[model samples]
Target: MNITDLKIKAAQIRIDLMTMITAAQAGHTGGSLSNTDILTALYYRVMKHNPTNSKDENRDRFIASKGHSVESLWCILADLGYFPKEELTTFSQFGTRLIGHPNNKVSGIEMNTGALGHGLAISVGMALAGKRGGKTYKVYCLMGDGEQTEGSIWEAAMAGAHYKLGNLIGIIDLNGLQISGKTSDVLSSEPLDEKWRAFGWHVIEIDGNDIEQLISTFDMIDHKSDKPTLILAKTTKGKGVSFAENQISWHHIVPTVEQLNLATIELRQQIEALRKEEN
Candidate 1:
C-alpha cells in the first residue's frame, strides 16, 4: 500500500482499537493506541508474510513483546483476514481466543507474549534457526521502553550481535512512559542508542508515528546485513485520543462511554483528512 493509504488504514485501526477496548470494558488502551501506527506499518507494508498461510516457513515473524497491546494486534490481524473480525468483540471475555496477550495457539500469532524481555530471546532463536536451515526469513520483535529494564533484554541483545543475526530487527516503542510513571523517573536508560550500538547492533531513531520515516527505516533494515537492527521509535504513550495522549493514567483504564465517543470522532476526522489528501 502507498504511504497515504497506509496512514488511512492506521487511522481505521485506531478506531477499531478504541471500539474493541470500550466493548471489552478492559484492555491496555494507552499502549495499544501508542503502538498502532508501528503495527500498521509492519503488517501492511514492512513484513513479508502470507495471510492465507500464516505458518509458512519462509514468512517473516512479528513478536509483540509489549503484549498488553494485543488488542491492536488482534484488530490488525482480523483486518488482514487472519481471523473473523467479529471475534474482536469477545476480547478479554470468557472463552474468547482473543486474550489480552497473544497466544501462539491463535492462527496468526507467532508467540505468546506479555511478560516482557522474552521476545528478544525467542527472536534470536528464530534467527539462528533460519541461518542454520539456510532460510531467508526475517524476525521482528516489538518491545516497550519500560521492558528495557529487564536484564534479559541485554543478554539477548548480546546473543543476537554475537551471532550476527542481520535478519533480526528489534523495534523499541520508546514512549518514555511505563505503568508507574515516566520511564526516566523510574529507571533512566539515558544513552539508549549508544547502548544498542555498544551491543553491536545498528541503531536508528525515528518518530514512531511517522509513516514515511517508518517505511524508510524498514527499507534500510532490509538492506542491512551481518548486524541486527534496532529502531528506537520515540512515540506518545496514548497517541491519537486527546484525553489519553501522554497520560500514564490511561495505561490500563477503560474509557468511559463519552470518552470513547469523542475518541472515535477524533479518529474519524483524522481519517477523513488523510483520505481527502489522497483524493
Candidate 2:
C-alpha cells in the first residue's frame, strides 16, 4: 500500500480502537492510540506475512513489548483477517482471549505480552533462534519509553549487539508519557541515541505518527550492518483524537459517551480529509 493508503488505514484503525475501548469499557487508551500508526504501517505496508498462513516459518515476527496497547494490535490483526472481527467486541470480557493484553492464543499475536519488561528479552531469543536456524525472517519488537527503565531492556540490547543480530529491529514508541506521569518525571531515558549506539545498534529517530515518514524509515532498514536497528519513533500520547492528545487522564479511561462522540467526529473528519486527498 502507498503512504496515502496507509494514512487512511491508520485513521480507520484509530476509529476501530476507539470503538473497541468504548465497548470494553476499559483499556490503555492513550498508549493504544499512540501506537496505532506504527502498527498500521507495519501490518499494512512493511511486514511480510499472510493472515491465512500466519504460522509460516519464513514470515517476519512482530512482538509488542509494551503490551498495554494490545487494543491497537487486536484491531489490526482482526482487520487483517487473522481473526474474526466479531471477536473484538469480546475484549476484556471473561473467557475472552482478546483480553486487555495480548496472549499467544490470539491468532496473529507472536507472544503473550503485558509484563512490560519481558517483550524485548523475548524478542532477543526469537532473533537469536532465527540466526541459529539460518532463517531469513526478521524480528521486530515494539517497546514503550517507560519500559526502557527496565534493566532487562538494556540486557537484551547488549545481547542483540553481541550476537550481531542485524535482522532484529527494535522500535520504541517515544510518546513522552506513561501511566503514572511523564516519562521524564518518572524515569529519564535520555541520551537515547548515544545509549543505543554505544550498545552497538544503529538508531534512527522519526515522527511515529507520520505515515509517510514511517514508510520511508521502514525502507531504510539496513540488513548488511552487523548491528541491530533501533527506531526512536517520537509520537503523541493520544494521537488522532483532539481532546485526548497528550492528555495523561486518557491513559486508561473508558471515554464517556460524549467524549467518544467528540473523538469519533474528530477522527471522522481526518478520515474524510484523507479520502478527499485520495480522490
Candidate 3:
C-alpha cells in the first residue's frame, strides 16, 4: 500500500482495536494506539511475510515484546488472513487463543511473547541464526520504552552489539507513558539514542505515529551493516482518540461505551481525511 492507504489502514486498525478492547472490557489501550503505525508500517510495507505460507522458512520474523498491547497486532494479523477475522470477537474469552498477550498458537505470530525484555533477546538469536545460515529472513522486535527498564533488555542489547546482528531491527514505542504514569517518572529510559549507540547499535529516531516517517525510516535501515539497528520511535500514547492520547490512565483502561463511540468517530474522521487526500 502507498503512504495514504497505509495511513487509512492504521486509522482503521485503531478503530478495530478500540472495538475489541471495548468488547473484551480490557486491553493495553494507550500503548496499542501508540504502536499502531509502527506495526502497520512493518506488516503492510516493510516486512516480507505471507499469511498463507506462514511457515515459510524465508519469511521475515517479528516479535511484539510489549505483548500487553496485542490488540493492534491481532487486528493486523487477522486482516492479513493469518486467521479467521471472526476469531477477534473471541478475544480475551475463556479458552480463546486471542488473549491479551501474543502466543505461538496465533498463526502469524513468530513466538509466544508476554514477559517484558524477552523480545530483543529472541530477535537477537534469530538474527544471528539467519546470519550464520545465510538466510534471507530478517528479525524485528518491538518493545515499549518502559520495558527497556528491564535488565534482560540490556543483556540482549549487549549481545546484539557483540554479535553485530545487522539483520536484526529493534524498535521502541517511545510514547513516554506506561500504566502507572510517565515512563520517566516510573523509570527513566531517556537519552535512548545515545545509550543504544553506546551499546554499539546504529540508532535511528523518528515520529513513530507518522506513517510516512515510519516507512521512510524503515526503508533507511542498514540491513547490511555489521551493527544492529535500533529505532527510537517517538509516539503518543492513545494516539488516535482525542481524549485518550498521551493520558496515562488510558494505558490499559478498557473504554466505556461513550468513550468507544467517541474514538470510533474520531478515527473515522481521520480515515475520511486521509481518503480525501488520496482522492
Candidate 4:
C-alpha cells in the first residue's frame, strides 16, 4: 500500500481497536492508539510475515514487550486473516483466547507478553538464535516507554549490542504518558537516544504516529550492520481522538458510550479523507 492507503488503513485500525476495547470494556487505550501507526507500517509494509503460514521460519518475528496495549495487534492480526475477525468480539471475555495480553496460542503471536520488562530479553534470544542459525529473519520488539524503567530492558539492550545482532530491532513507543502519568514523572528515561547510543546500538528518532516516517525509517535501517538498531518513536498517548489525545487517564480506560461514538465519527472522517486522497 502507498502512504495514503497506509494512513487510511491505520485510521480504520484505530476505529477497529477502539470498538474492540469498548466492546470488551477493557484495554490499554492510550498505548494502543499511540502505536497503531507503528504496527500498521510494520505489518503491512516492513515485516516479512505470512498469514497462511504463521510458523514460516523465514518470516520476521514481532514481539510485543509492552503487551497490555494489544487491542491494536489483535485487530490487525484478525484483519490480516491470522484468525477470524468475528472472534474479536470475544476479546477479554471469559473463556476466550483473546485475553488482555498477547497469547502465543493465538496463531500470529510469537510470545506470551505483558509482564512489562521481559520482551526485550526474549527478543534478544530469538535474534541471537537466528544469527547462529544463519537465518535471515529479523526480530522486531515493540516496548512501551514505561517499560524502560525495568532493569531487565537495559540488560537486554546490552546483550543485543554485545552480540552485535544487527537483525534485532527495538522500537519504543515513546508516547510520553503511561498508566500512572507522564513517563518523565513516573520514571524518566530521558536522554533516551544518548542512552541507547551508549549501549552501542544505532539510534533513530521519529514521529511514531506518522506512517510515512515509520515506513521510511524502517526502509533506511541497515539490518546487517554490526550494531542493533533502536527506534525512539515519539508519539502522543491517545492519538487521533481529540478528547483522548495525550490524556493520561486514557491509558487504561474504556471509552464511554458517548466517547466511543465521538471517537468513531472522528476516525471515520479521517478514513474518508484518506480514501479520497487515495483516489
TM-score between model 2 and native: 0.98
Q: Which stretches of candidate 2 lie over 4 Å from their true place?
A: none
State every prediction's TM-score relative to the real structure: 0.98, 0.98, 0.99, 0.99
lDDT accuracy of residue 86 in candidate 2: 96
- Residues 1-279 of candidate 3: C-alpha lDDT, one tens digit per residue: 999999999999999999999999878899999999999999999999999899999999999999998999999999899999999999999999999999888899889898999999999999999999999888999999999899999999999999989999999999998888888899898788989999999999899999999999888888889999999999999998989988989988899999999999999999889888888
In candidate 1, clashing pairs total: 0
What does candidate 1's lDDT look like per residue over 155-263, in tens digits?
9999999999999999999998899999999998768999999999999999999988999899877534889999999999889988899998988999888998999
Tens digits of per-residue lDDT, candidate 4, 1-279, equal: 999988888888999999999998988899999999999999999999999999999999999999999999999999999999999999999999999999999999999999999999999999999999999999999999989999999999999999999999999999889888888998898899999999999999999999999999999999889999999999988899989998999999999889999999999998888877777
Task: In candidate 2, list every pair of residues with a backbone clash.
Answer: none
| Residue-pair clash count for candidate 4 | 0
Model 4 residue 23 CA deviation in Å:
1.0
RMSD of each: 0.9, 0.8, 0.8, 0.7
**Ten contiguous residues minimizing lDDT sum, candidate 3:** 270-279
Q: After superposition, how far is residue 115 of candidate 4 from its true place, in Å?
A: 0.5
Best by lDDT: 4
